[model samples]
Target: MLSMHYIQKGLLFKKPPPPNNQKDFIDNLLENLKQSISLALFHFYPLSGRLVTRKTQDPPTYSVFVDCSNDNPGARFIYATLDATIYDILSPVDHPPVVESLFDLDRAINHDGHTMPLLSIQVTELVDGVFLGCSMNHCIGDGTSFWNFFNVWSEIFQAREKGRDAVVSHQPFHNRWFLEGCGPLINLPFKHHDEFTSRFEAPKLRERFFHFSAESIAKLKAKANEEANTNEISSFQSISAFLWRSVTRARGLAHDQKVSCKLAINNRPRIKPPLPKEYFGNSVDVVSTETTVGELLENDLGWAAWKVHTLVVNHDDTEVREMYEKWLESPIVYQLGRHFDPFSMVMSSSPRFNMYGNEFGMGKAVAVLSGYANKFNGNVTAYEGYEGGGSMVLAVSLLPDVMGALELDEDFMNVISVANFANMP
Candidate 1:
């Protein structure tokens, strides 16, 4: 009954290397951004359209579609001036609450898409830099697909500025893939849905930014594999395992208390024959692994990493089809979440995304941040480090006390190059 919000993220950029006296740089950039979005909407038409939800009888189901009629309002572009600096937003001790204002939509959830723009863009000009924030309906696509659209938009912007036809790679694939029993206008039972305009409040928590260098990540993987006595530990699995152990230990929960780690997987490559590389829309599915606090902490990092890896390895094409089949019979839709229990942690998004590659003529983004939308205790956002190697950065949100404990835990800090408060003894 949840997930009625946009997926908003911010890309921080410094003012262009040299201020030009010829023309206003900000004005030119804004114009190019708008033009680029307009061209992007040509392929991603759904972003320019409104959502149409109709009630159906017999099954008490809701049928939703993107209304692409001529009169529909297109994407929104907001230009805001902020009196804050990039360091304030990037503060490691406590993530700045002001980051939420960087987005355009004012508490409008995804279902509000019927009246509001499906894609909201806000360019917050900070005192020292600009924060490019985008709010997109989760129904429009998953994180991967959204970045694909972003990459295309930047490509177009570069081509336009260079006075040439855009050789856009990774063109969007709008071919919707519905379940076997579903039609174009998919219907799902929704006797009573959530309030579309409001957003639920998440528990106030402490968040920290953790950086894992390419070498550190490799060490985590190697350590996990060595301890497990199996050379099959993946990088993601190793890090996830480390977090689970480190956090669980920090929480000091009862020995028998169960803890589950939720993670989202892209279903594009898992399906038989695989969907197109640029397949648009939400094709994400979630898988979770759980264990008691005692068993988790009593074991080595490799044990936990292997546990996470097993679930991922097991969720193969057959498992994927079965999950889809069950959903078709009795659909349980949203693959991402907003509400998480106190003992739960979710590792979200992927470091594999082309975060630094979104070059809009200005140099690549300095760092990335998230809106306060899905901030819950133990909610972690993963992004590739700005300096391009195999490095990764995690924005981890946790209970205040748990974060306090995590700050003191030596194991967690060993593999991470703390961005701000890892030295809190």
Candidate 2:
């Protein structure tokens, strides 16, 4: 588990009409959701538990084990109603709504071990829709675990509405010791971890949502493959490459300034034998590719894309296993925090998360937002757009000046669709 971090996700769904004999739609929805969450918690019991730190070791460690006893403090769940419509968030604007404003402030996950809740849910009913805000302690799980819980909760709600038993296709595997055999026992210094986390404190940056239509993505892929002189490029590689170049240009760095792009790669599939679909925890490695700002921007887009692709391709199962072994031996895992050098961009989240498929018996999610962008600058969280058809939404946070420059880049804006507030403010 990645301690000291919170994965906050907001999902918006269209409000369904009141069922037969139900007077209030929002009240019925809230009741149903609360009941579903309670049912889901029976399976994901750890989320209802608190963190227990073991300080007896040379380096302290923490574990979030299930505690269903009477004294156990359960996960926090809040229900509220918002006066605004979903358009107040999804409509095109100079800046997207602060991700924090979408949820209840008191219910957010606290990083402090003493008061942190493993999971917090706030369902806010909007004028025309409903917003489901989830704040989960990263120490208990990652985005994968968070979404898995959400899907399961939604399934339970849908099943109850249909008067049927929900079938849980995959049950969560909570054995953190499963990876012990992959590497040597290494002590993690709590102080060092705290210091590393402190470096990611909220920066003075603006977050904007950029939509890339299917056609734009196609153009990017085509250009990247054509430039790389190979058809081996993937959509992730292509978009990453394009963003890397554009962001570098936006920073307007000197020719001698070096720039790097760090991508969060899911290590679950890369591991030998592969982790089970239900294996939930922090299983991500930040892999990076570097180049001079001049070279990155001056070269063809495909060139940068190729570099990104190679970085991912080189991290095969063997390399991943070796990394695990090395991580096990190291006293501290220093994640790529805010870089002090020549500029760097870190991208997290993936279009493969199926952000739009979370249907809670109401329709699919019309919009998805992440609150993490408020804490980390140069952070770009990607999601599968509701429009589908290979569309993507990039929730980007960067320094104001750099974002200004990025919006002005003609080459970068060529394929962007202005219909969805993607144009400059």
Candidate 1 stretches greater than 4 Å from native: 17-19, 58-61, 195-198, 333-339, 420-425
Clashing pairs in 1: 4-110
Q: For model 2, where is the 10-residue window of minimal lDDT? A: 416-425
Evaluate model 1: give its TM-score: 0.93
Give the number of the best model, judged by lDDT. Answer: 1
Worst ten-residue run, lDDT, model 1? 416-425
Estimate, for each residue in 261-343, the C-alpha lDDT of model 1 and write its tens digit.
87888888888878987998988877899999989988889889988999898888888888877866785544224346778
TM-score of each: 0.93, 0.88
What's the lDDT for residue 178 in model 1?
67
lDDT for 202 in candidate 1 is 64
